[model samples]
Target: MSDVKDRVLDAAVDLFARQGYDATSVAQVISRAGVTKGGFYHHYASKEALLYEVYGDLIARQLTALEQILARRLRPADTLRAVIGDLVGSTAASAQRALVFWRELHRLGHERTEEYRRSRRRYHDAVQQLIADGQATGEFTAVASPEVVTFTIFGVINELPLWYRPDGRKQPAELATELADLVLAALEG
Candidate 1:
C-alpha cells in the first residue's frame, strides 16, 4: 500500500475506534490522515469501504497466519497452542482496529459483509478441523464437539478487545499460553 493509503487507514481506525463508524465523517478521516480528498478517494470509495478494509485487513492477516502455522506440520496440540498465541498477540497489538471492526462490521454492504464473513469462516473452519483431526488421530480425546470447542476458543478471542489491555502487566503471550493450556487440558484428559 502507498504511504498515503496507510495513513488514511491508520487515521480511519483511530477515529473509528475513538468516535465510532456512525459518528466519524469522511472529512474527519481525511483531516486526520492529512491526505487530500482525491488521495483518499483514490484508495477507498467511501467511509464504509474504509471501515470494511479495517476489519477485512485484520482478518485477512489472521487467516494468512493460520495458513503459515498449519504449514509447519506440528502435532495438533502444538499447532493449536501456536495458533492461540498468534491470534491473541495479534489481536492485542491491534485491539483498536479489532474493536472498531466488531462494533462497526455490520455497516458494510451485503456483498462486502459476506466477503468478510466468508474469510472469517475460513479461519474458523480451519481451527475446528484441527480439533477434529486431533480427535481422529487420538491426540485429543473427544471431550467436546469441534463446534463447541471452536466456539469457546473464538468466544474468548472475539471478546478480548473489550477487556484486554496491551499496557497491562499481563501481556498477550502469557494470556495466550494460559488460554491454550486450558483448552489443551480439556482436550487431552
Candidate 2:
C-alpha cells in the first residue's frame, strides 16, 4: 500500500473503532486521513471499501503467512506453533483494526461477509487439520478433538484485542511463544 492508502486505512480503523461504521462518514475519514476526496477515492471506492479492507487486509496477510508456513513442510506440531505465533503477533500488531473490523463485521454486505468467512475458514481448517494430523500420527494426544483444539486456540487469539495494550509487560512475540507453549503442551503432553 502507498502512503496515502495506508493513512486512509489507518484513519478509518481509528474512526470506526471510536465512532463505529454506521456513525462514521466518508468525509470524516478523508479529514482524519489528511487526504482529499480525490486522493481517498483514488485508493478506496467508498467508506464501505475501507471498512472491508480493515479486516480484509489483515486476514489476507494471515492467509499468505499460512501458505508460507505450509510450504516449509515442517512437522505438524512445529507448524501449529508457527501458526499460533503468526496469528498472535499479527493480531496484536493490528489490534485496533482487528477489534474494529470484528465489531463492525455485521455491517458488511452478504457477499463480502462470505468472502471474509471463507478466508477465515481456510485458516481455521488448516489449524484443525494440523492438530488432527499430529494426533493421528501419535505426535499429539487425542484428549480433545481437533475442532475443540482449534477453537480453543482461536478463542484466545480472537479475544486478544479486548485486553491487549501496547504498554503491557509482555510483547506480542513473547505472548505468542507463551500461547504456543500452552497449546503445544496440551497437544504434545
Candidate 3:
C-alpha cells in the first residue's frame, strides 16, 4: 500500500473502532486520514471496502508469517512457540484493528465474510494439524484432542485484544512466551 492508502486504512480502523462501522462515514475517514475525497476514492471503492481491508491486510500478513515459520522446519514445540509468538506480537501491535474487525465482522457482506473465514480457517487448520502430528509422533502428549487444543490456544489469542494494553508492564513478546509455555505444558502432559 501506498502511504495514502495506509493512512486511509489506519483512519478507518481507528474511527470504526471508536465510532463503529455504521456510524462512520467515508467523509469522516477521508478527513481523519488527511486526504481528499478523490484520494480516498482512488484507493477504496467505499467505506465497506476499507472496513474489509482493515482486517484483510492483517490476516494476509499473518498468513505470510505462518508460511515462513513452516518453511523453517522447526521441531513441533519450536514451531508452535513461533506461531504463538507471531500471533501475539502481531495482534498486540494491531489491537485496535483486531478489536474493530472482530466486533464488526458480522457487518461484512457474504463474499468478504467468506474470504475472512477462509483465512482464519487456514490458520486454524495448520495449528490443528501440527498438534495432531505431534501427538502421532509422541512429541506431544494427547492429553486433549488436537481440536480442543487448537481452539484453546486460539481462544486466548482471539480474546487478547479485550484485555491487552500496550501501556501495561507485559509486552507482546513476554505475553507470547507465557502463553506458549502454558500451551506447551498442556501438550506435554
- Top TM-score: which candidate number? 3
Spell out the clash pairs found in candidate 3: none
Leading candidate by lDDT: 3
lDDT of 2 by residue, 5-70 (tens): 999998898889888899999999999999999999998887777888998999999999999998
Tens digit per residue, CA lDDT, model 3, 1-189: 899999999889888888899999898998999999999999888777888888899899999999999999999999999999999999999898999999999999998899999999999999999999999999999999999999999999999999999999999999999999999999987
> Candidate 3, which segments miss by more than 4 Å at Cα?
none
- For each candidate, the alpha-carbon lDDT, in order, equals 0.93, 0.92, 0.93
Better of 1 and 2 by lDDT: 1
Candidate 1 lDDT by residue in tens digits, 97-129: 889888997798998989988998998899999
In candidate 3, what residue range of length 10 has the lowest lDDT sum?
Answer: 46-55
Roughly what TM-score does model 3 have, to 2 decimal places?
0.97
Task: List clashing residue pairs in candidate 1.
Answer: none
Candidate 2, residue 82: Cα displacement in angstroms equals 0.8
